[model samples]
Target chain A: MQWETVIGLEVHVQLATQSKIFSGSANKFGAEPNTQANVVDLALPGTLPVVNTEALTLAIKFGLAIGAEICTHSVFDRKNYFYPDSPKGYQTTQMDYPIVGPGELEIELANGTKKSIRIHHAHLEEDAGKSLHEAFHGSTGIDLNRAGTPLIEIVSEPDMSGPAEAVAFAKKLHSLVTNIGITDGEMSQGSMRFDVNISIRPVGETTLGTRTETKNLNSFKFMEDAINQEVERQIEVLESGGTIAQETRLYNGDTGLSRPMRSKEEANDYRYFPCPDLLPIIIDKSTIEAIRATLPELPEAKKARFIADYQLSEYDADALSSETKLASYFETCAKTSDDAKLSANWVMGDVSGLLNKNDMHISACPISAENLGALITRIKDGSISGKIAKQVFESMWAGEGDADTIIDAKGLKQNSDEAALESMIDEVIANNPKQVENYRAAEADKRKKMTGFFVGQIMKASKGQANPGLVNKLLAKKLNG
Target chain B: MHSKQLFFTSIGLVKPFELVLEQTMSVTKDDIAKVAKLARIQIDAEQVPEITHGINEILSLVDKMQQADTTHVKPLANPHDATQRLRADEVTAINERDKLMANAPESDSGLFLVPKVIE
Candidate 1:
């Protein structure tokens, strides 16, 4: 029996704010436990929560970037659960109305086909604290420093059919959020987390099957692996006449296995009610307009601009404009080197390969854009051959001086001077008298192939600094004569 | 009855107490037990009847208020019609871990320790 998989992603993005969502505590990562927790974050008696203006503004900024409808009048509600991570008995979240409404994101598949995924909504909420299970005998340690961090939970419709589309959507969303400057987009630090909902059914069935949610997958590879594992597990169970249970499961990235979280079974009933301590938030039209004005140049717009301004190919423009740092680097390099095509090739080829090898980001690249541009300029102006420029690039990466300094110090300049190249070609012809006589006596086709022998001799005489193009031209003129 | 009427009146519910007393509202002992378990509270079996009766009385009062014509009324999130106050995003709180951990029953290494709550 053929089965089709359905998937949806709920992504939690931590907003880049200076303080907690509803408190004045510091919202930094890797602080000592409980140090950033204050009276309101701790949920002390007689302490009330006041919303942070920057959190709301950033949330609106995201909504505008996605072209979603902004709910001017939104309210907070209480989600009651019992856990050590939550000091209060309930979590404050948006239930009925959220800041962002239904929107859509377009993703390009590997086949170059575009598909639109619908975004259900995004809401503002406070994050829960951390629960440390290790270093304690028969007890759990709770750290409340992360209890009240501001987050916007982006919920998507179950529009994906397989792991590839899901990964594509995830990458597109990551680029979009980071480009807009709302979140730090750091998956390792838990700034952006994904929860994948996967279910499978007969290929032609319209109604959905029972879905299990794999929660808190931080990396794109893990998300793809978890989805594939869960889908296989579901198909196996159904084929054996077993049913899939609707529960939340934890994906162990190290072992590549998932199991149902036992603690979440009985804790599912989140009795929700409007939070009375905080009133409704009514944003004005002018405020939305003001936030819309602050939206930066998003990924699609930047890609288009890169193509138009740099005269780059569609593929090269897409690759360079996906990240803000790489886009700026390419622009500077292209402008300085005066060659967009060559700049694109070097940036996407050698530079990217080096970054991947060193496990570093483009921002940490040792070869500065200006130095790389200077190297490219040397290649274009015949100061150094393209092959030799690579050597210069390596030296520059090793903290050696720029292209001009390295070229001068190593005496690696191309011998493009016509007079010098002709003397070297004349010497090659005189030394290889038999080859020149054979070339002059042979037909045009055989004579054309015989020119390589003379060029090789001339290049060997010049110690590889001799320009191959000039050697070929001069050798043909001397040997034919 | 007067106190019940005033309780509804104070929250802006204009229902009379006698109307609630006439209605037949009930809370079973099993319902009380279930609620107590959900709240993680310990309750004695002998106190079940009294607690059930007290809960039934409160439910009747709520039922009377629910009968009011509120078709055009919006759900009141807060008592006052004021909007939520916004705070500037500034880190004004400092590390008070020592003073705050003093309130915990058991703490070690700047963490609040509780009975093992493993998942």
Candidate 2:
């Protein structure tokens, strides 16, 4: 029997606030361990917790962006667990009444079809500290710098069927959050992480299978890898006449393996109740509207704008507006060049290729958007052909001067001079007599194809500096005669 | 799976003595044992019943308060329907690793050292 996989994702995005969620502790990343912890974050006996208004505001922004229902009154619950990472013995989180409820995110699959993944809910919660086992010399060390940091836990419905759809959903989510300027969505620094709940059943089965959660996958590639591995593992167990145990498994990303951290027989009891320290966060309609007014242009809206305003194809617009930095970079280039289609193509093609080759993000690209725009401007004004502009772009990527300077210094401008282009075509017709005869004898449609041969010769004789359109006109005049 | 309630003081302007209905869940000897383990406290088996009896008598009064019949009363996280004061999202604290480590029982390399924990 064929198998089908069921997947749902729970993502934790660290809100880009300057302070901890419930305390005034500084929330900078990579601080010395325990340094960012305050009395409240450290769980001192006398310290009282207070709600972070900025966290609430950002959570509301997320709810508004996704069109989720913003719960007017949400209470904080203490999720009790015994661990060194949580010094307070419990994590303060929203349980029954999450801040956001029942939203959907639209994603585009690699096959160019749209999918709407329903989000079950999203809640605001405080993060626990890190447990360091490697450098502790037989003891575990705790880093409380991450403790009490505000996070929005987005829970998605079990709507995805495979790893590809799951990754598409995650990438769309990352784009949405980063575009809206809520979180940086940096997977490396643990800014955004995911816990995948996956199960496999026989194909066409209506009921759900037992799911085993794989915890704390920080990158998209590893999340996909872990899900595929888990699905295969479950399928093998069932094929061998075994049952899939519901457990919490720790995924080893390097080995593509997972081991059960908590088996079905040894599940921890996380006693949860309303936290008495915090008050119910009462959100009025005015507050939600206030946050809605402050919303930035989200990714889907920006993509639509690219298609509408710039007349870009859906594929090009999606590629150009995938990231905020790239989108703004493309916008700057397009606006500067006044050639939106050309700018979109160059940014998506050459710029992205160079960025990928050099191990850089669009933000750290060496070539400025303004300079790239100027280069495209040269191409538009017939100062340089598209071929010469690529050379200029390569040199500019190597930190050479601006487009005009590169064109002037290297003599790489297009030779649109009519006489010069004609002379080159004359040289090609005189040298390749057999090809000229072949072109003159062929039918109109067949001769159209032979024009490429003469055009190649003319361009080669000019050393690729001659204008192709002018060369084509001059070649046809000389060859057809 | 054990479910037990831990007492936490309400900071929402509710008087401590007036929160009588919060005590409906009476603590049993089993609850005391489970809570002691969760809190990482040392407790003798003989003392569980004594502590359970002492805690239940107070809880009985709390349970009796539930009969006051406040059907129209809304459930509130804070007794007072007061709005919370908002704080600007700013970095008010700085790294004080040494001062913080002074409060820890043990420390090494800017990290709090605890007994080896897995999972």
Q: Tell me how far the alpha carbon of residue B57 in candidate 2 is from the true structure, in angstroms, after superposition.
A: 3.8
Misplaced by over 4 Å in model 2 are A1-4, A108-115, A201-207, A262-267, A425-454, B1-28, B55-71
lDDT of prediction 2: 0.84
lDDT string, candidate 1, A1-481, tens digits? 9999999999999999999999999999999899999988889999999999999999998888888999999988777677889998788998778889999899998898899999999999999999899999989999999999999999999999999999999999989888888888889999999999999999999999999999999999999999999999999999999999998999998998999988534577565667777898999999999999989899999999988988898999999988888888988898899999999999999999999999888999998888889899999998888888888888888988988999999999999899988888877777777887788999998887877787778778887788888788777777776
In Å, residue B108's CA in model 1 sits off its true spot by 3.5
* Model 1 B-chain TM: 0.72
My TM-score estimates for the predictions, one after another, are 0.90, 0.89
In order, what DockQ does each candidate have? 0.45, 0.42
Please give, for residues A1-481, the per-residue lDDT of candidate 2 as tens digits: 7999999999999999989998889888887778799878889899888888899998989989899999998878877776788899888998777889899998777787888999999999999999998887789999998999999999999999999999999998998888878888888999999999999989899999999988899999999899988998999999999999888888887787788984432436666667777777889999899899999888888889999999999889888887899999999999999999999889989998988988889999998999999999999998888988899999998888999999999988888899878877777788888988887888998988989888887778777888888887777777777
**Top TM-score: which candidate number?**
1
Among all windows of 10 consecutive residues in model 1 chain A, the one with the lowest summed lDDT is A263-272
